[model samples]
Target: MSLTHDATLRELPTEHGVLRYHEAGDPGAPPLLLLHGSGPGVTGWRNFGANLPLFAEHFRCLVLEFPGFGVSDPTDQHPMVAALPAVGRFLDALGLEQVDVIGNSMGGVVSTRFALAQPDRIRRMVTVGGMGRAIFSPSPGEGLNLLMEFTEAPSRERLIEWLNSMVFDRALVTEQMIEERWAQATEPSTLAAARRMYSRAALEGMAKAASTSPEPPYWAMLHQVRARTLITWGRDDRVSPLDMALVPMRTIPDAELHVLPNCGHWAMIEQKSAWEAAVLAFLTRKD
Candidate 1:
């Protein structure tokens, strides 16, 4: 289910675990790495398939699967902490001196931490429907149970429900999108991973705790993000509300905000053209 298309998938060893990734565009082009969110059956392709070619036209694009998700080998280490070193290893393996990073949701969380720790490694960062900035305050929009929705009784209907919850306009959710996600969700191994995501004891504080506790303490040091940043959000997003974007807009010295109306958490999918254009303009700007 992961390689349903013609995209080339590759694997490499990282400090955290084996990493699987896909790359496209010219070798000489500036590199841009796309990181995905945490959701059942989420992979780089699922999150940014509609985006790769458009972005590749300007810059080399590399999309890496999270250490434990997609085809990448699962690790007992907390997936969150594991992600930091894993990304470092990925860059080392590729000999990329610096890259522009675009992250969504959980991956956006990772990018923020990565930028703070290794500011020189990232030229610019874009976060869409991101989390981890909620340390200041948690705004649970629409009050949906994201983790339980998948774990209770994983089904096409459930995935659709979760998908609909992310969007202001439910009709944008295409049937093909539903079927593809359903296929990945029904896959025996992916479903098992989905179960672990919500219930795994080792992943507490990383996933489970982050999901359950409204007051889950977070360290959103927005002041530390030195790279030019673009924060995008669907005004109707429930997982990470539009209010969450305001924190970065107000704090990050070089950050800009773009709120898409009638959009959902999956901007690249729901609002593909506008999302791509906004990102390209931000990454290419001289000043």
Candidate 2:
């Protein structure tokens, strides 16, 4: 039988508000906190939807809903850095001293920041297509504009086309995926929340942080992280290309990297078997 839905729904009262989380598998198993990317329809489940059942069998997986995403309460602040405190609060509320942290894209940036600020709280780190230095072909804002246009477009096909632009494989853009994303993106609060999040200053601030943070960019930080690390990427990812991950593989002494060929940005969804195998192998390593 599948795990009970209630078994996965959990909440933690933080200083900001009550954050919603989904926990699966044995409560006493080792802990893993999963963080999702930032996008028009991002949520923890959307990021790891395909890997949940597999991860549940081995680890106590907690999928976090970031502020303004999913069912979580919106924060007064705009930038993600402002929300790091809440992550710390969630960890404290759960009475967890340390946890394995896994994140993608924007969430990866937040995870890296949290680890840097509170290194003692992180046990192991795994980042898939995680953030790093700025890589702009046109402009960073162009990506946001494309998503916004397609998300607000009246025609469903156009929306799917725009969504598919982020991935290498068009077949992965199923109707169910588009409908699910549209439902979340068109929620009453999403526009207002996104407006706050992408104000010119907020975007500029994020750009600056990406370009000039004193701490090692994600790659540099990978070297300093005391915990064992695993890095995975989709070979055909359009958003954060695997071409950029090469330097990090050499820098991190204890890190292992896996690339899923023919997969797109959503490795968890497109090539789940390989992704799960890599993740489980890393987590179970006795070294």
lDDT of each: 0.75, 0.72
Off by over 4 Å in 2: 4-7, 134-145, 148-158, 198-201, 208-222
- Scored against the true structure, residue 206 in model 1 reaches a CA lDDT of 57
State the lDDT of candidate 1 residue by residue for 175-236, as single tens digits: 98788777766676556666565543434435556677676333447777889998888776
List model 2 lDDT by residue over 38-103, tens digit each: 766778877875677888888888888888764688766763654577788888888889999888
TM-score of candidate 2 on Cα atoms, chains taken together? 0.85
Model 2: how large is the Cα RMSD against the reference?
3.1
Model 1 segments beyond 4 Å from truth? 1-4, 14-17, 132-144, 186-189, 192-196, 199-219
Q: Give per-model TM-scores.
A: 0.85, 0.85
